[model samples]
Target: MSDDCIFCKIIAGQIPAKIEYQDDDILVFHDITPQAPLHLLIIPKKHITNLNEIRTENADIISKIFTQIPKLAFQFEISEKGYRVVNNCGKDGGQTVFHLHFHMLGGRHLEWPPG
Candidate 1:
């Protein structure tokens, strides 16, 4: 894990986060600055820099994240209401943290062409 990465620090117990779920390969937590009523982040334990760095070998880890999204949405009381999962890529994509993560947002109407 990169020492400078915040998500890595969170995963290592070096930084505090409102964790929602955790397993051997992944961790889910609440967003510090929430955009929606239920804004959460799903992250992998491995220190991947971004989505471009994901490899075929990481399929299982990625798949597990997808499989848990619905459950997490339900837990956050947003499943029946619907939700959106997002991944910001690079600087232009508005990614502040380099570590790969997915943002789960719900509990409000999402408009088209998100900024």
Candidate 2:
């Protein structure tokens, strides 16, 4: 884990987050700043810098994260109306945090051609 990464701190229990779901490989939590009525941040407990950093060895963890998203969507009652899964790449992609993470957005009509 990166010494200065905020997500790492959260995963290591150095910080407090409104955790939603957690397993050996992943952690799901409510976004501190919600863009939708249902906004969840799904991340892997193992630190990954970003999407570009994903490699073969770590691919399974990424897959596990996807496998959990739908379940979380259902748990948060957003699956029926559908939801958006987003992963911002870099600074240009609006990824303020360097850790690899996905944002699950639902509970409202998310506009097409998002910013």
Clashes within 3 Å, all models in order: 0, 0
TM-score of each: 0.96, 0.96
Evaluate model 2: give its lDDT. 0.92
Supply candidate 2's per-residue lDDT for 71: 89
In angstroms, give how far residue 15 of model 1 lies from its true place: 1.0
lDDT of each: 0.92, 0.92
Tell me, what's the RMSD of every candidate? 0.9, 0.8
lDDT for 91 (candidate 1):
94
lDDT per residue as tens, model 2, 8-40:
999999999999999999999989999999899
Which one is best on lDDT? 2
Question: Lowest lDDT 10-mer window, candidate 1?
Answer: 73-82
